[model samples]
Target chain A: MVKALVFDAYGTLFDVHSVREKCNEWFPEQGEAISQTWREKQLNYFFLRQLMERYEPFDQVTREALRYACKANDVTLRDEAEEELMEAYLNLDLFEEVEEVLSQLNDKKLVVFSNGSPVMIDPLIDRSDISGYIDDVLSADGVKQYKPVPAAYYYAQQELGIEKEDILFMSSNPWDISGAASFGFRTAWINRNGLPKEELDIQPEVEYENLKGLLEWRD
Target chain B: MVKALVFDAYGTLFDVHSVREKCNEWFPEQGEAISQTWREKQLNYFFLRQLMERYEPFDQVTREALRYACKANDVTLRDEAEEELMEAYLNLDLFEEVEEVLSQLNDKKLVVFSNGSPVMIDPLIDRSDISGYIDDVLSADGVKQYKPVPAAYYYAQQELGIEKEDILFMSSNPWDISGAASFGFRTAWINRNGLPKEELDIQPEVEYENLKGLLEWRD
Candidate 1:
């Protein structure tokens, strides 16, 4: 009886690592490392900021994370290179199955609920092939809070005008699933990496390898 | 003018990685990897739990983090090995200069304020050589909130009966320093590794290579 499917954007639908090519162009032989560290620190910055009650938009956090990633990887991030790398986030590649699955699930309301700022996520969605399949895009920025914070998910529930139990929230990030599930949404953990589940006491109600598995929920 | 000095226990006064030897004995070459991931995941769990309003005690969080770290590194963690590794946390070695610095700053009230539960941090403090130098130990467990969250620092301040400005909070972790600084405490970042500063908008009042720098602040 789920009426809407809310998907996490960055890792669940978009390939954040797609920026590796641009990063590799700037930092030869270090693109993969920079991208990996950048992604890790990006999430860390969000969690840290949320805990400290210091909320910065995702774009700025992404840039700061890039700067740290570059320094940690021993590469200098030239100003222009940084701008181009940041640009790359706006045009991230969609996961191989995203468009097909979204199209199939179009009868059910499909929404993007993410920690990504609208300035970043809007363009990303519009540029992607699945944009037409999405009914709404919600950003945590609207609430000035990040995911895993109850307020962020509550904001989404309120905006969609849907009951939490009837909204299936999907995220590749375990922490996000923990948050959404704890906030009362029926959760589907899109564990793309097949990695171990986080040891957090809360568990997602369902687990899937990718978005394709999400098609099972479409009514 | 500072009347009290509050310190972060793990990685500030105590070497959290000192558990490497025990980890190595249990898992051989994977010890270093396990310890590093264990520490990183340990902090991540605290931040995640704090954001989700799921407040598990630090000891429980530490144990869960260890379980994930072992699974992540592709090592099998036996039940007995898990208990032994958890035991190592109680007996972590202090940073080389911690005892000397605390001894030198005897005129100042020295306190250990940590995310650790009292059950964990109490024995850790009592067993350490600097036990005689410490005046009080305050734990975030009392507030059921982790550091970087304002409540945790406020708990420390109330317990010590000191004004925020007159308390110099020291930690090797930048996020902890940011939290303490934002809460109005004078902060000293013990940048033992000389890593680049995090891009959080806040900055510590002072930066030092190690505990020895605390001696400089004494009246």
Candidate 2:
């Protein structure tokens, strides 16, 4: 039952919401609104780009969404603010328990399958001091699709030389978990929002409250 | 050339978020969060279903997402609460100016192209007192595609029996406006959020703060 535990980067193993903290420091007037808009727009861009069939780097897409949201919310962040936001992205905080949970899963193959570029993810993983425990880092750029794309899961499987069934895909986004399930991979949806998955035709094989639950989960 | 004016139903013509007012009476503890999560998951379901080549009535999708979000936020509602929410959806408040603006364009073929089901939308139009001004109500259920899907525009055009070039698609969602534009229809994006459209290599021919701008728009 032990195979690869493929962890999704944003909102799964990492404290993606902490990106808000960094924004608050820069644009105090409308920081919270700008940050919320940025997150919403970033996800919107992901799906929009997928539908449009035009792939762009996650960093570029994230930056574009942040810039527009700042403007819309009447938060004027100069070029330096933009750079600071991008730096925040590269330096995203790891969830408080991510390192310990990941270490427990280290006995099995541990891989990072993310929509982010290697450049963006590498620094975070390195900063977490858990890079040594990771077996591989797979980027969506190679597959030309973001999470919730079947190809994204397939890319990680193909790159790791494992069957879909051998990879236990994990993500906080229900759609990403749905995609993995559809692709015939066993999945543990990290429902950190404490929500149920949207009623899709396929359901996840396992649902965990967070990585801690997932750490104790054995198939 | 006055040919046709199309409007997005949610947030543009109808005040969909006004439903939040009733949330306090039902799930007072997490009313605001419940409402926000419902809207977010509703869009998530639409995009995921469209990407997966599956379709469901927006009401079913809406109810499912609502239930998920409510549970996630620890808000428990009685069955009557569901009925109340559904009723709220059908009884949306139109902006003070929406009726007057639609009246101006009524002489020139006004239509509603919505992401709602006919069941969900038709009732709203009937209750909102603006049904008399609309010539047609087109829903994604007709095409098995949601807004931002290229097929939504094509299906609307075919249903309207109008050439793509002659139809003006209007929406507050940039993704939808961009999709309609890519589908070869002219679009006027209602930038109600004051945000620029992300760089998707697609652009709306017109941009406006509200539908009133469209009444005076001459092209």
Candidate 3:
């Protein structure tokens, strides 16, 4: 029954925390703490900016959050190291199953509904060499708002000329699943780490251990 | 140019984490963890719910977040103790300068713009015995949205018949100050713990260590 399959980019297909290795190489012993703080701050700023009605592009949010995280951890983020980390983000390795799963999809019009800015996500998807498999890429900047804002999902619906129920929205993050489902889409969650579902009372139609497991979806 | 004053209730006027003692008592060695997780989850649910377009009243948010936090910390939350902790929330102690500062206000209409439900905020204000000092208590439920939502702030402006520039919004949270300022109100941050300013590019018109220092605002 699903017409279009929409994927969340960060942490679903892209491994965001992979930057920790480069961070470790640069910051030495405190790399993990800084990287952890950076990720947390990055997500926190998205929520904060959305609530405040001040929309910052994902690139700016990432950079500013890194600055704050570095300051918090007493790490001196020199210009080169800062560039190195951000450049590393654009090349985050896909999970082992991502390319294989995309190749196995049988004629579903696949697309990405991402919070990343076009300039950031487009290059990453291209560099990952999986751009050929996806039908289109959608970004929150199309409406100047991020998920799980209803309008963000609505943008995808209007663009594809499909009903919400006709789209299968998937995310590894529990909150994204709840949001897309709450907005009336058929959602499947990739619960890779097997974390407990969020307490929001919303559940996805299917749960998968990894991208490869998505091959089992029938509709 | 300021015509009236609006105060953010939590963490500014009332100490929300004061219920930690009860949490500690019930959870034993995990009291601090339970309390910290509870507070984090509570704020997180606010953003998640807001983004998901699922609104829960502040009191309900508190209960649900507390429940999740207890589960995460591996604490058995019996009904009796759960009620005890939630009830204690409604009786949180006000900072020492709250009443004195409210009392010292000259002629500006004093009001609270809070995320709390009336049931929660009213009793807390009453039990703190500071009901006489304030003019009115406005809850987010009145607008069906919570703080940092521009609509939530604009509701106060419309209710009080004041221009945005004429209302001085004060919140201890740097993010709240940024939001209020971006929404066109003059803001003062009660930086109680001397936290650094957020990187959001909006600065409060004034910063103070406590409510009494609000007396320093000349406008």
Candidate 4:
């Protein structure tokens, strides 16, 4: 239905929990909490930065949020664990079904639209050796904003030099999907949490449990 | 010092932990997680709605976030306990030191700047019997956008009919303080979490461990 299928990166492509699981081994005492706080602050930083009209790479925000989380949880880590967490994030294993689905979706243009910084997402793709399969990776870097901002969708559209209606956006986060949907993109929601749609004014055009469901959905 | 002394209701005045403690008694199984999720979604709704140019009452978002959290966590509630959470939120007990400090600050123009609805915060003051002491109860009702938006602060400023610099905004949440600071209001950060100051571009003019710290400095 759309020329390009744009997927969200963190929860959709990468195994976020598994990355935390790996981090837990090295920072045994506070790894799990670190992971959760890191994720929370990651989202928080994205929103706050967008509001402030300042943008930094996701890696920098990741480090900042990770440090703040450590302080909040009373976990003391020298620079080592921060580096470890960064490394763990950069080397995340793609979801079990990600590559297969991406291959199938590759019949059309496949792009990643993420709140991640270029430094963070690019290295992951390179390390995973999926660079050949992806046509583009668009980060929120330029706009200093994250998804759910209509401007975020506009950034991706402008960067790719494509019309908004021709881009099929998908995200695991309901708020992001709602933003994309409202911004005039055809959206497929990856409802990993199985939560019902929010009572927002806008709604996603398609809903699937995950990427596999998306792959099974014929246009 | 600035003229108006604005207080944030949830964590600064009301003991949010006590609110959760009350929740733990009711749901017992999934209460804590549900409470946490409720808080997250409540804020998410506020920020998302603000971004979308749609304004709903904070109480509505609170209820929706609670419903979604309960459903997400598989916590089924009977009638009263479900109602009790909202009741508990409205009738929240002020922290042990709240009344004395607020009484001391009553010499200045005082306002309750909250993301809550008028109905929500009005009852809170009425239930606490501190209604007469407060100069004004400013909810995000009229503006339809919640705090952290320039528009929300502008609404508060417009309501007070005071210069932005004349308002001394205070919040237990750093982001609120950051937002207020960005909104051109002088701010005092109530760092109850004892967390480090984030690297946000905005900074508070004053920092206190709690409201009591402000009382000592007040002339």
Q: Interface-residue RMSD per candidate?
A: 1.2, 2.4, 1.6, 2.3
lDDT of 1 by residue, A169-194 (tens): 99998889999999999999999999
Predicted candidate 4 versus true structure: per-residue lDDT over A1-219, tens digit per residue: 578888888887787766667666766766677778878888887677666556677888888888887777776767777788778888887877778778777788989888888889888878885677889998877786778788888999999888888888888888788889888998899888788777666899889888888777666
DockQ, every prediction: 0.80, 0.40, 0.56, 0.44
Could you give the DockQ of candidate 4?
A: 0.44
Give the poorly placed runs of model 4, Cα more than 4 Å off.
A21-26, A80-84, A161-163, A193-201, B16-30, B76-88
**Cα-based TM-score, every candidate:** 0.97, 0.88, 0.92, 0.89
Residue-level lDDT tens digits of model 4 in B29-75: 65678778878778787788776656778888887777776776777
Highest-scoring model, lDDT: 1
Candidate 2 per-residue C-alpha lDDT over A20-136 given as tens digits, one digit per residue, 9 for 90 to 100: 877888876566787778887888898888876667888888888887788667767689989988888877777777788887776788988888887788787877767889888
Which scores greater on lDDT, model 1 or model 3? Answer: 1
DockQ of 3: 0.56
lDDT of each: 0.92, 0.81, 0.85, 0.80
lDDT of 1 at A68: 94
lDDT of 4: 0.80
Clashing pairs in 3: none
What is the C-alpha lDDT profile of model 3 across A1-219, one tens digit per residue? 888888999989988888889999988888789888888888888888998888989999999889888888877889999999999889988988888889878488999889899888988898886788988998888888888889888887898899898999889987788889889999889998777556676779889898877787787
Model 1, C-alpha of A214: deviation from truth (Å)? 2.0
Compared with the true structure, what per-residue lDDT tens digits does model 3 show for residues B150-195?
9888887888898999998889876677778878899899998777
Off by over 4 Å in 2: A18-25, A28-34, A126-128, A193-202, B21-34, B193-201
Model 2 chain B: worst 10 consecutive residues (lDDT sum): B193-202
User: Stretches of candidate 3 above 4 Å error?
Assistant: B106-108
